[model samples]
Each structure stands twice: as structure tokens, then as C-alpha cells.
Target chain A: MEYRRSLLEVRDLHVEVEGKEVIRGLDLVLHRGEKLALMGPNGSGKSSLSMALMGHPGYKIKRGAIVLDGNDITGLSPDRRAKVGLFLAMQNPVVVQGLSVTNFLRAILKAKRGEEVPIREFREMLVKAMGLLEMERSFAARYVNDGFSGGEKKKLELLQMTLLNPKVAVVDEIDSGLDVDALKIVAEGINRVASEESAFLLITHYRRILDYIRPDGVAVLMEGRIVASGGPELINQIDRQGYDWLAVKTA
Target chain B: MNVPTPPLELAQEPEELKNIRRKAWNVYTQAPFPDRASTLWRFSSPEAFWIIPENISSMLERGKITYKLEAPNGLLLSDLQQAVSDESVPVGALVGPEFGKFEALNLALWERGAYLRIPERAKIDQPVVLRKHVSGEGLVLDRSLIHVAREASLTIVEVLEGELTGNGNGYLNAVKEVLVEEGAALTLVEIDLTRGTTRAFVTARHSIGSNAELKWVLARFGEGVLKANLGACLSGQGAKSEISGAVFGFGQGKSDIHTFHDHVEKRTFSNIVLRVVLQDRARSAYTGLIRIGTNASYSEAFQENQNLLLSGDVRAESIPELEILTDEVQCKHGVTVGPVEEELLFYLMSRGVPREDAVRLLVAGFLEPVLGHIPGDFREPLDGRVAHSIKPATEVENVL
Candidate 1:
């Protein structure tokens, strides 16, 4: 059997927001080409963990190191982390008034590649990505996330993820507000981007998305720490018995 | 310094204009400096713009003033001084010396001026471009009078560029009066590109006739200190006016802007939108007013001012006021002053954009709406100016 190197490792991570610790002593790892489902109930530090991994200034890492591909990114800025191939699809994307989608996508691509992409080439890439997400061509001209529907915002996130093709992508609640059809499209986007050189950590409160993008491993997070980790059957077990059983076991 | 006597060169003007200049000079010498306690002068000191009498004479003698005007046939475009001597232009029909002290000084000391007239019932598809360039030190005054005849339509773009040389600071006072006749439509764009040891005070007033329309755009990207007063009077029934301004302040720049919209007739409409971006210790103060007269029933008026502070050292103050004397009128005003939202910055930075580029993108987006109101040809150059004004984050530290 071939050896698969771990792409992302979170060791003893402690995160505090506004001086209140939200993520405490959490450890997780994902190997290359692995899809990990991080299941947690509401306010279980799922979003905080994603934010901390992305180096959000507001999410303070009191005591932890986020290693990506053997590089310690604990002290990296958000832009630096992004440049190093760490992508975080925020749950509620902010509205940047007057910034067109086309300009933003081009800017991000240039920032990542460290060079300007020709206008025509960028347009082709944008069209392809938007088409894959089932987005209309007019979406290119619309301001970023301004007056966007929940489904449209999610689609935009997926479009960005597809364009960046990062080594590790933490998709936070990408399927929460999406309908079944939209979920299918999002799942297909993730599946197409999945490769041996990349990994995905899908953070969600429900296992509905796990049905489409079958996870190789499932981890249940409770009270700022992982309580259980198992194979795909653990998802069916949690679905049948609920998280109470896991919470009881952890206690 | 005490008030200086009127210049002796007023004696060289024609009888009619000489009288006007003398009267304006008298007003200029007699009017006391603006009180800092007054609302109009509270944020800015009038002393910064005050010019000594001796410097005014030297400026009149040594200043270099050149202008180019392009207009279609049947339109009258000529030197304002010559037009005044020919008695072909009304000197103070819309605005007079009594309008203010700085206005009086401009009327008395202006050596370079232009007069433009669009003939009645004539429609010019292409815009008339007016370029005025001034280079020198001391006090430079330029005046412009634009009249749109009844049923005529015209668009005028006035570009003001200047460079001040020598060790002493330069003072510039420019006054413009625009008249839109009944049933006429006029679009006026004023671009200010003055830099280097310059103190510019500009005042522009517009009078709209019955059923007339006025579109006014003001773009300010100048260094040093600037005090501008822009006013619009919707005097006739169904008169409409839209005034939009974009100001970018950087590198120790200071700008004080005041706008007034007066709805004087029934069913008249007016709207004003002003956006200011300040960085690197630059400061800006904006006060806008919308007034609806008691007799102007059913009139509508709106005013908005938004300020974006890019650095911690930068300061911005915005005040939008409305006085509606009639119950049937619709009047609204909004004002906002704040630094760039941190969340918005994080959202952009998370996409791999550096902090400086993120700030630039956000500032560009913040100013996009107002810049959208500008013409394409004029907007491109202003974009360059805006980019220049937004310095890197390293230089402007503590940027949120």
C-alpha cells in the first residue's frame, strides 16, 4: 500500500474570541485526498475552528499550531495563509458594495498566482467556473454578495473554491441553506475539485451533505473538542441514535 | 494682516464692468474675515485663504493663465473680460459680490475669465470642453459665466489645473455662475487638479428656470487646503437639479465643502450626493443642506454625504441638514463617517489579497457609486488620482 502524507494537522488548538475561549484543546488531521466531515451541533466551535485555521485576527489562538503540508501557519496572516494554499469558505460571506464579481475573482487569482492573468483568459476561466456552479452570466457584473440570495451566495463561495484550487479547503456550512438541487451542484463542484493533491474539511451541523460527498472519516465535535472519531458507519450510527449517545459516551 | 485696499487696475475696465469691479472691491475690503465660531467656518479657518493686497497685485502681473474653449457654431464662447467690455454678458445676474467675501475678491481681482452661451433651441450633441491652466505663485483668480438659452441643451466640462512655484504659498479664488433658461438642460462637470503649496477657494452657483434641468458634478483631487461652496437654486416650477461630488484627500490635505439645495418653487426637485475618502492624516468636513420653501409645496429634496476614513490619523466629519417649511414636501438627508469595516477587510484578505490591496479595493468600491456619475473619459483620470491618493498600508499604519 502507498503512504499518504497528511495535508493538514491541527494539534491541541485553543481559540479565544473576545477573551472567551471557544475552541479548547482540539486535535485533528486529514491526509492528502481525504474528505473529513466535521459534524457538530450549533455553537459547538465549528465556525471558530475554521476561522482560527484561516488566521482571522478576531479568533485568537491562545495555544495551538495549525500545520499545513508540514508548515506551521500558526502565526501567518490571513492573506499569507491563503497564499500558502489554505482556503476557508465562510458561512456568511460579507457584502462588499460596488466590487463586481468579475473583478474580485480576477484579483484573487492574481494574488494567488502573483501575476496578472490576461483579460480573455480570466473571462474564460470565470465563465467555466460559473457554468459549473449553474450561475448565470449576469452574476459576473453583480456586486460581490450585495443583495444576493442565500443560494447565490453559496454558489459564489463554491465558484471561488473552484477557481482557487487550494491544497486544503475548509468549507463551513456550504450546504445549510441550499436546496437539494443546489446541494447536488455544490457536491459536484467539490467532487470535481477533489484530487490526490488536495483535501477537504466540510463543517456542518447535519449529515445531509455527507450523503452526497461520502466522507472517508467522520468526527463529532462537542463543547470545543472532538468527542468521537470513526469511519463512515459512525455517520449512520449518529443519524440513527443521535449525538446524545456520543455525548454520553464522552462524559 | 489688515484688509488691503482695492487694486488700482480697476480703473482700466469699461465703465459698466469698472463699476461692478469697484463695488466688489469695496465689499471685499469692508467685509470682515469669517468668524471661526460660525457654522460655515467652524471646521476651517478663513485665514488660510486670506491673500495680502500686495501679493494680489504681483499675482495679477506675473501669473500665467491660459484657457481653451471648444463649442459648436451659433454658440458664443469668448474671454469674459472682453465680453464684459462688449456688454454681451450679464456680470452679476445670478451671483454678485454680496454673495460672500471670497466671491467679492474673485470678482475684483480676476484677470482670467470665460463667458459661454448656448443659443436658444440649439442642441449640441458633443460636450464643450474648457481647460484652464495656471502656474505661478501668489493670488490667482479666474471667473466663468455660463448661460443656457431657452430650450437649448449643452454639456460643459471645465478642467482646472495649476502648479504653484516659488517658496511662498499660492492662493487661488475661482467663482462660477451657471444659468439654465426655461426648458433648457445643462450638464456641468468641474475637475480640480491643483497641487503644491496652493490654497484654493472655489464657489459655484446655479439657477434653474422653469422646467429646466441641471446636472452638476464636482471632482476634487488637490493637495493643500480647499474650501468650496456649491449651491443650486431650483427657482421655477418643475425645475430639477442633481449635484454629485467626489473628494479624495491625501498627504496632509484639508478640505471643507458646503453644499446648499434650495427648492424655491412648487413641484421642484433636487438631490445631492457627496462622498469623501481621506487617508494619511488628511481631513475633510462636509456640511450639506436641503431647504424647501413654504410656498414650494409638493417639492422633493434629498441630500447625502458619506465619508470613509482609511487611516487612524485621518479625520472626517459629515453633517446633512434639511429644513422643510411645507408639509407636502418630501425631504430626506443622511450622513455617515467611519473607518473601513474590519470584517469587509478580512473577507477580502482571506481571498489572498494583501492588506493594502484589500484596502484599495474597498476604497474603490466605496467611491464607485459617486464615480459612476462621472463621464467615462473624465472618470479614467480620476481613477488614477484615486489610486495615487491611497498609499500603502506600511506608510499608513494602524489602518483597521
Candidate 2:
């Protein structure tokens, strides 16, 4: 194992949704700048882990401790967690009808920076980021995610990641609905945001996105717990032989 | 409540004008208080809007009702009394006691009124502003008539405000009648920012002629109680009307709004979009109707009412009704009443914005469709009012 400083640690996390345990006893760790891909079957609680980490009110943390950098953040609110450098890219972004994309992005930026960013400067940054995501200039003026295509929604998630530059990013199935071209652009965006001080936890059900942005490590989650963890070879094994073998072994 | 006797000065007015007032007074005295079982009065009680005769007389004697009008050249803008005496305007033609009780009272006792006539085939570069202010406690009556001549284009902004005195409760009854002639375009914006303690009753009726267009915007931000009846009749072919409204209610405010789109001719078009945001213990009830008559073939009408509840204590009701008597017409109506989506708030909060700020953003977005229709000069002030209304009660009290 490499000797790298840890950025995020989830210790024996137990999450409940609607009074039913989802993430029973999951433990995970991501070191600085490391890209860890979490692979699981359809009902393996992958999305639950992402939502619980972000302090979703619907996802109750039954028992766990989430440490970011060196602070215990299990009791913090969602906005507090974000302020301490945590970001979660939702699987399905909601449609806000009248909130323009530019206004939403600027508001988040202001919240993160604790000060107002000059309009001209913010416009330049937003335009540059939109261009990188292959979005039109008029995209900034549109209401947030309203009437947006599936691929466009995914691109918007990546665009936020590129701009926020958080220390820990948990992207849940960002590649689920993207086309080949949009997947390439989104992959490029994630790679660009990966830095020495930032760690990535990619949650997915397929190996296609892993091919675009290689993962430093792979972990398999099954029935609310991490059943296996290893180097990139784990992904290859899962690709060849589906999770049935891992499930049998873990059981 | 018994109807107050006609003012002594009423006898001195022109015979025609006095006759209209006398007829309206009779109607007001004869009409019974609206029954709660009626659809129009189901959500609100007429007692909340009842005005004492003594208060009305006192306010009238003290001259507490005032009006200011600003218009361009070649436009006919005059006092309602002058316009009626000169035989230049037909008062009480569109609205009368038959409309409603409050409307009849407004027509009979209105002390502050304006009549605006736009010349034929003329285009006004600037909007005509009518500001009606009631400065003392008691009952205030106001009426206005606007006629946009054929092929003429004009915009009118009506601002209603109140300044209460002492511990007395204030009541305001207002009526407006607008006529858009053939091929004319009229944009009427009514902004009501009455005091929190004032009870307001407002009724407006618009008639659109052949090939005419009417755009109506109503922005309500007052507290206390408000009952508004806004309607438009499409009487000619190729006529179009678009009504957009936004209301923000806070504290213990109660608001009941009704809108009507009556299509009487073929090939007419109408759309109504109303958005409301309620905070604190505020409550709102919205009922809208789209009626396409048998002769209104090939007409199209759509109505949508959306209410956003900001607190658990707040209540909202939305009812959209559609009546289509002819086949070849397209009529649809939708009503939505719900609290802000938790998913939306979570999405915004996950990006570092606080919960309060996130809720504010969602509410502002929910109201943007209608608020965006406000004129540029008034948009910012209304935005401020909305922002202030959404704050926590304790914080709002502190700021106040």
C-alpha cells in the first residue's frame, strides 16, 4: 500500500432509508488524489452510501462516523459538509423552473467562497466551464436543469464539479445516461478536477466509465457492506465474471 | 350592514351621473351579503370586507382618498366626475351593481376616480401611471375607466397603496373597467401594496375587441385580507388576452383571488398564469375559470395556477375550471398546490447554500414566471418585497 494522507474515511457506516437498513456496515477510505471506484450490483446500496454521505434528510445515518480531512462530520448539516469541501453529484438532478443556470452556479460559488464574485469574473469562469463541457453559451441563461436532456444533465453535474473544486467528490452514476460523446466529455471533466488535494469516489454499476478515467483502486459493495477491495484487477475480474461470484464468496 | 345614505354633494352632480350613482346605491342597499355556499364566496366571508357607514362618511368628509395621474399628450385623462359631466366617458357601463356587492358600493361612493382615453391609431411611447393613495383610517372607494381606441397602443400601471392612521382598521374597495377596441393593444399592470392592516377588495373587468390584444398583470403583496375578482371577455374574433399574476403572503394574511376568461366569439385566445407563495401562517385560495361559449369555435384557452407553501402552518388551495361548449376549441386548465420539494432543497444545500437561502431560491424560481411579467421599473421593488416576506418571522420583526 502507498503511504498517502487520507482525505475521507467512512467508519462502519450504517444508513437507513424508510426505517430499513441500506448501508449496514460499510467502511471505506480515500487517500489524497486517489480515484476509488465503488462497484456494486443493482440493489447493493451504492447510491444509498452517496446520499448518506451528503446528509440527505431522507437517508438516516443509523450509526457511523464520517471524517473529512481531520474533522468529525457525522453530525454536520449538508451545507456545512459542503463548506468543509465535500461534493456529491446527484444521479438525477431536479428541475428548477425559473432559476437560471448562471444564478444558481454563482450562488453556490458565493456560498463556498464566503464572498460575492464579480459578475464579469464569474461570467468568464462560467463560460469557460460550459465550453469545456461542450454546452452552448446560452446554456448559462437557461433555468437550472429545466427541459434538459439526460446527457445535458450529466454534463451539468460535471460542470459543477469542475467549478467547485472540492476536496472530496462522490459522483453517483454520472455515466448512467450519458452517450458515448458526452461520456468522453464528462470523463475529461472528472480527470481535470482530480488533483493532489482532492479525492474521488466514483460509484457505478458498469466498467465502461472506468475505462475512460482509470481508478486507482476498486471496491465491491454487496447487501450494504464492502465485500471486497483491491487494486484495478478487481474491476477486470468483475467485468469478466459478474458480481455473483463475489456475492457467493462474501456470503 | 345598512347602506349609508348618499352624500349631500351627490345632488349637485350632473343629472346623468347622479342617476347612475342613485341606481348603484339602490343596488348596493338591495343586494344581500354573499352566501358562503356560492363558489365566488366559498373561501372568503363578505363580513371581512364590510365597511362601517360612519367610517366611510368620515373618510369622505376628510378627503382621505387621493389620486395622481401621469399621461402623454393627446390622451384624455380626467377626473371621473369631470369625464361624466362633460359626457366624454360612459361610466358604469361595463361594471355595476350586477357584478358584486363591493363593486356596487365602489361605483356608488367612489371619491377618487380616473378616466383615461387613448386617441385612435396613436401609440403612446410612455406608460400612463395612476397612483391611488388612501391616507386615513376608514373606508376608501376608487374607480377607473380606460379605453384604448382602435389601432392605438398603450400601457397603464395602477398602484394602490394605503397609509393607516391611529388604531382604526382601514378598508378599500376599488373597481376598474378597461376596453380594448379593434386592433388596439393594451397592457395593464396593477400593483397592490396596501398596508398590512388594511382590508382590500378589488374588481377589474376587461373587454377585448376584434383583433385586439390585452395583457394584464396583477402583483399582490399586502397583508391582512384581500378579495380580488379579475375577469376578461373576448367579444370579437381574433382577440387575445393574457393574464399573469403573482402574490406573496406573509404573517396572518389571507387572500382569495378569482380569474375568469370568457370567450364569446370564434377564433379568440386567452391564457391565465398565476403563482402564489405563502409563508408564516398566511393562506391563499385561487379559483380560475375558462369558459368557451358555443359560438367560440376554433378558440383556445389555457389556465394554470401554482401555489408554493413555505411553511407547515401555511395553507394553499387552487381550483381550475374549464367549460367548453363547442367542439373545435382547445381548453385546458391545471392547478398545483404543494410545499417546496425536499429534493430541490437538498440539491441546493449540497452545494454549500444554507437551508434558508435554498428555500428562498426555490420560491423565487417558483414565482419567476409571473413576476417576470412585471414592468422593469417595478420588478426590483417587488423582488425585495418577496425576499422580505420569506424571511423567518423573528428576523422579519427584528428588521422591522
Candidate 3:
């Protein structure tokens, strides 16, 4: 049997925001098309780790390195990193007024792809992605994330993932503000992307999203470090028992 | 370039109207030009004031005036001469003979103007567009009288544009008088996109009757200096007026807009919303006042001004004043001046948009709500101008 090689490796990563360190010494490895569910309690630095991986300007990588496909992208700008096949779905999406959804999506896609896609091809892909995420057709004309409901925002994030088709995705808290139906739709979209080509670092506090997108592995995050990593059974233990056992083990 | 001397020839008016012009000329000569100490001119620079040029004949030699009128059957649209000569016209009803320095200068030096009178109960479906262009480097004085009769409805859109003819300085002084009778409505949009080192003084004095409504939108994007003053008197009960303005300054441009709302009777309502965006070394100031008279009970007035400073060199000031003398009145004013939110920029950049593109998007978004208040036809052009104004500043290669 052939084995796929690793696409992304986070080695002993330490990150800070506004001079305060939040993510301390973390390591993770993922191959192409693999999905890893990152579970942790509140303030466990799950979102910060995702941001630091995506090269968010607010995050200061004090130590360690982010290697993507044998290249260290730790010092790359956010846009440069995105062009090199990285995507981040923010936990709290910011609203950009006057920029329509279609225009923003097309611009980012152009920046990532290094060329403008034909209008017909772009529209087709956008329409298909919106359909997959259960977003209304009229949403294309609305401003980016402006006055959007929580579920709609998550759906937009998923739609972006489908259109961009990045090599690696760090989705932060995609299931927190979503209803059951929306959660299922979002999960399905992520799963489809993972199955196609992209590897995902799914950040979530609850295990509900795992029901739809079956993770190949589960990693328990506590105090900015991965306390334990195992197969899918770790989620079952987490669901029945909770994070207390993992906390005790880490302590 | 010789400056223009005032007291130009009158275009054949009645004796009474001619006397009014003479009085206005006297006022123009007697009153001193506004200095920095004046309350109305505090934020405005004294050096930017241009005297009325003496080259009136040169201005007439260049045939740069263009007027077009499209109205319903009952509406009367003609030149100012015909309207003032007609017996039924009220010559000095809305704007008095001598209102201010600019008004006096406009009435005295103005040779021709547009006269629009909508008959009682008549409704004009499409807006009447009045576009003016000034080509030469002298003073161009113009005036307009708009009267929406009882129960009538009308919309007038005025666009003033001109180029600097000789030494890169053009002067345009305009006065607009509007009267909305009982149950009538009027919507006026004034867009100034004149280029060059021009100075524009545009003032609109309007009076609203009982149950009447007035919607005014002003967008000042001239390349030079501008002072725009708008005043509305809610003279009758239930009179309402809403005024929205979008002002942009770039490079060395300077713009100031002053608005006043007077609630003279009971149950009157007025709202003022103005947004200014500046970059580079440009400067802009906005002053708004809402006054509720003693008899204006149950009246409501709101004023809000927001300014977006895209660069550190840009300057903006917003001052909202309110005076309430009556009980049971709702009056409030708000002012905000700041740069774009960094978090919003960070969010857009994370989506693969470059830093410049993100700043451009944020600026557009910042002015979206104000631009939305204008007509849909203006959305594209105004947005384009707004985009161009901030292009240079946002194009910096440094993304940090």
C-alpha cells in the first residue's frame, strides 16, 4: 500500500498576542487529505494556534517554526501564506461593509490562484459552493459578513473553503454558534474538502462536529500543548467522560 | 488675469426685483469678508477666500452654461427672467434680498438663473437635472428658485462642474431658494465635481409648510475649496426634512459643510447625517445645528457626523450643536472621527486580500451607509471617486 507524505508540520510552536504568550510549545503533523479534530476547554489556545499557523499579524511567533511542504513559512505574510496553499476560517469573522460577497471571494481567489478566473467559471464554482453550504443565492450581493447571522457566517466560511480548495486549512470554532442543521451542513462541506485534497486542523470545544466529519485522529489540547493524541476512540472517551481525565493526565 | 468687478448688468427684471438687486449689491460692498474670528468661518481658512473677479465680460464670452428642463404638463420651468417677470411669482419670499455675503454677491452679479415652479397638486415623476459647467478663471454667479406648490411633488438634481481657465482658480457662487407648500414634497440632490483650484459657496434656504417633506442629498467632491451651507425652516406643523451629505477631501483640498435645522412649529421633524473621508494633507470640517422653538412641542431632531481619517496627515472636525427651548422634544447630536478599525483590516487580509486592498475595502465599507442614502444612479460614480481619493495612500508597499 502506498502512503502519503506529510504536508504540514508544526514543530514546538510558541505564539503570543499583544505581548502576552498564549500558545506555548506545541507540535502537530498532518498528511495530505487527513482530518484532525483539535479539542480543548475554554482558553486552551486552540484559536490562537490556528491564527499563528495562518500567520495572523496579531500573533507573534516567539519560537518554533511552521513548515509547509518542506518550506518554512513562519515569516511569510498572511497573503503570501494563503497563496502557498493555506486557509484560515476565523472563529469570529469580521464584517467588511460595501464589499459584496462575490467580489471579495473573487478577489481572494485571484490573489491565491495568481490569475483571474473567468467570470463564468467563477460564478459556477461560487454557486455550487453556496448550494453545498445551504446559503441563499442572494447572499452573493450582500456585504462580506456584514449583518450576517452566526450560522450564515459559518456557512460562508465553509463556502470559502470549497472555492479556495487550499492544501491545508485551520478552521477555528466552526461549530460553536451553529444550530444542529447548520452544523451538519458545515461538517459535510469540511469533510468533502478533506476527502478531496485538503488536510484540516479542525478546532472545536465540543465533539458534536465529529459526528458528521469522522476524524481520523483526535488531539486533546490543554494549556497550549497537546496532552494526548490517539485514534477516533479518544472522542468517544471524551464524549462519555469529559476533558477532566485528560486534564488530570496532563497535570 | 484681471479680477472681476461686481454690479454686473441685470437681465431685464421688474423694477421691484431690480431694487432688490441694488440693495444686495450695497450689502456686498459694505460687509467685510468673513475672517477666521467669525463663528461661521472659524474652521475655514481666510486665505482661501476669493474676491469677486472683475472680468465679467470674459465669463460671458465663454459660453459654458448649460441648462436642461424636463417636467410634467402643469410644471413651469423657465429662465429666472421669465419667472420673476411673471405676475404670479413671489420674488423674495423664500430667500430674502440680502441673506449673506455669498448670497448678496450671487444676486448682484448673477445674470441668469433657472426658475422652476410646480403647479398645485402636480407630480413630476422624473428628476429635473440642472447641470452647469464653468470654463474660465473668473467669477460665475448663478441662482435658482424652486417652488413646489401645495400638494405637489418634485425632484431636482443639480451638478456643477468647471475647469480652471487661466491661472488655476475658478469661482462659483450659487444660491438656491426652495418652498415646499402644504402636503408637497421635494427631493433635491446637489453634486459638485468641479475641478481645479476653484472656490464654491453654495447655500440652499428652504421653508417647509404643513405636512410637507423635503429630502436633500449633497455630495461635494470638488478638487479645490468649498463652503456648503444648508438651512431648512420647519414653519408649519408636521413638516419634515432629512439631509444627508457625503464629503471627500484628498491631497490639498479643503471642504466645510454647515447645516441648520429650525423647528418653528409643533411636531416638526428633521434629521441630518454627514460623512467625510480624508487622506493625504486634506482637511474637512462639519458644523450642524438643530434649534427647537418654544412652540415646537413634540418635535424631534437628530444630527450625526462621522469622519474617517485614512492618513495621519489628514485633519477632520465635527461639531454638532443643539438648542432646545420647548418641552417634550427629542433632540440629540453625535460626532465621531477616527481611522479604520485594525481588526476589520486584519480579518479581510486573512482572507488572502492584500493590505492595500483591505484598506480600500474598509474605506468603501465605512462610507457605504452614507452612500446608500443617495440615489442608486450615483452609487457607481461616487464609489469610484471615493476609491480614487484613497488610492495613493493605500498603495504604499509596506504592509505592516
Which candidate number has the best DockQ?
Answer: 1
Cα lDDT, all candidates: 0.85, 0.85, 0.80
Reference-based lDDT, residue B397, model 2: 19
The lDDT of model 1 is 0.85
- What clash count goes with each model? 0, 0, 7
DockQ of each: 0.64, 0.53, 0.62
Per-residue lDDT of A143-185 in model 1, one digit per residue for the tens?
9999998889988988998999999999999998889998999
Worst lDDT run of 10 residues, candidate 3 chain B, spans B391-400
Candidate with more favorable, higher DockQ: 1 or 2: 1
Give the TM-score (vs. native) of candidate 1: 0.94
lDDT of 2 by residue, A152-246 (tens): 89888888888899999999999998889989999999999999889999999999999999999999999999999999999989999999998
Global Cα lDDT for candidate 2:
0.85
How much is the lDDT of residue A85 in candidate 1?
92
Is model 1 an incorrect, acceptable, medium or high docking prediction? Answer: medium
What are the per-residue Cα lDDT tens digits for candidate 2 across B1-400?
4655773345446776667777777666677888898778889988777665456666655436778877776665688777766665777778965777768778777766888888899898798888888777666777888889999998888887766543445667778898999999998888877776677787888899999999998888856688888899999999999999988888888899989899999999999999888888889998888899999999999999888887778889887788889989988888888877888888999999987788788888988898787778877778778767677432221100
- Candidate 3 or 1, higher TM-score: 1
**Chain B TM-score, candidates in order:** 0.93, 0.92, 0.91
Regions more than 4 Å wrong, model 1? B1-14, B70-76, B394-400
